[model samples]
Target: MPAPRMSTEQEIEALDEVCQRLAGFEDAISLEWLDGYLTAIVASPRRIERDEWLAKMGQGVFARAYADPADAEQAIKVIDSRFEVLANQLDPELILDDADVLRLAPLMIELSDDDKKQLVADGHIKEDELHLLEQTGEVWAIGFMDATHDFPNDWPDADLETEEGQLFDECMLRVVSLTMEPAELKEVFDELYDGEELTREELIHEALYAAQDMRLYWLDHAPKPPQRRVGELPGRNDPCPCGSGKKFKKCHGAQMQ
Candidate 1:
């Protein structure tokens, strides 16, 4: 047989009991297990519905003795901390391949620009290809190529300047902008012209992690560029700085010696 539905007062009493038991255990425990255990006591097989009186007795013990309420406070904190950990583990970045994206185009076309950008930021879709999913009243279709894709022949060449191309460009820019905060993003923006081979994703992740630690603005104290040393002029018979097989006299010796 099913257990009777708990009344509001009965639920409060049950919650108090659980909270009291939780306060007693100093060690960390799985919140899922604890919730299930509490529910089981009130569930059909056990039918221990009036556990609130037990809870009140526990609370009276807790309140009358301890000089400080640190234990009670910590009990609530641990539950919240466990819940957050679980939530983070459950939600992770999604990876979409070309075919997977194409399949989603119809539903995606209806989403607004902000939502599209959010999807890209969350790793659900590629920034460059998201704008391609534009929708008419009932039709959804691919857009055009952009400078970012280097104008691949996969898409029509002339469509590069059309609404589709513009939309694609806008979404890409928004993805870049939304990937990190301003100061964090600037490191990557600077890196773009620094001639390094680092990928955009790598740079973005580093910047975001730095921002989270509140150390993003620091330059990391890179070693100063080494100074070049001036040397004495070489004689005509000396080895040449040009690294030629011939001595200086035979290799631009007149120009230096």
Candidate 2:
């Protein structure tokens, strides 16, 4: 039997616990970043293997051995669950419902007063500018960019020639712009938004829309999984469905026998 599905609140609580446990590690990504990473994977043009993507997560933190094996296992389980949830939300075959749409939304990071104070101390922003910045979605954007960088070949500059491709490019740029410094972001805003300043909410809205568009684009453009007859197995000489170059008889079919 399949495992029980977790509610949105339950998932949030689970992710929060994992993040809290890893608080000492500066490089450990938060729930927001993980959400963006999983979103990119769901919308990717090619299917990424579970092991490969999990290793790529948090710069391979999830794949590393921990002092407490149970802690590592628990964290991995939460990450896996989140990935599964995202995959289901973006499944092309399903009609998007209200609940699915809500679940598909990105987990944006909101900066608290303490966080803003730290940013000022760290020289990331001015104390006066703290009031201007709300939830910037910077961390989530970085996570999305990381996933794209992993599979650079999948998103090519040549795509910019098409209308849909251009839109995709704009969307990606909008989200990535959140990662820029304030001065840099101002320049981008002038170029992309006709010198009109955007609020943090507007920027985050763009990021959310970009993610939705990416899912739609990949649903239409990505290679479809090969159709198979029900209850039929691959022929001994056929290419393995697992995507291995080896023939069936030389791969998983060999194990069956």
How many steric overlaps are in each model, in order? Answer: 0, 0
lDDT: worst 10-residue window of model 2: 94-103
lDDT of 1 by residue, 1-257 (tens): 11212224444344445444645652221222233222212111112223332233223333443336686564445433333332222111211111121111111123677988898999988999874543221120011111113222211222346664454333333224423444655664565435443454444333222222211111222223459998886777789878886888888776644
Q: How do the residues 1-257 of candidate 2 rate in per-residue lDDT, one tens digit apiece?
A: 12323437888889867765554463547777767777788778878887777666666665443448787777778877887877766665452333134335567778777888899999999988875664458878887888877766655452677897787787787878777777888987898799898887877776676676676777566654668767788999999999999999999999999
TM-score of every model? 0.17, 0.66
lDDT for position 81 in model 2: 81
The candidate 1 region of ten consecutive residues with least summed lDDT is: 137-146
Q: After superposition, how far is residue 241 of candidate 1 from its true place, in Å?
A: 88
Q: Which stretches of candidate 2 lie over 4 Å from their true place?
A: 1-7, 20-28, 65-71, 93-103, 112-135, 223-257
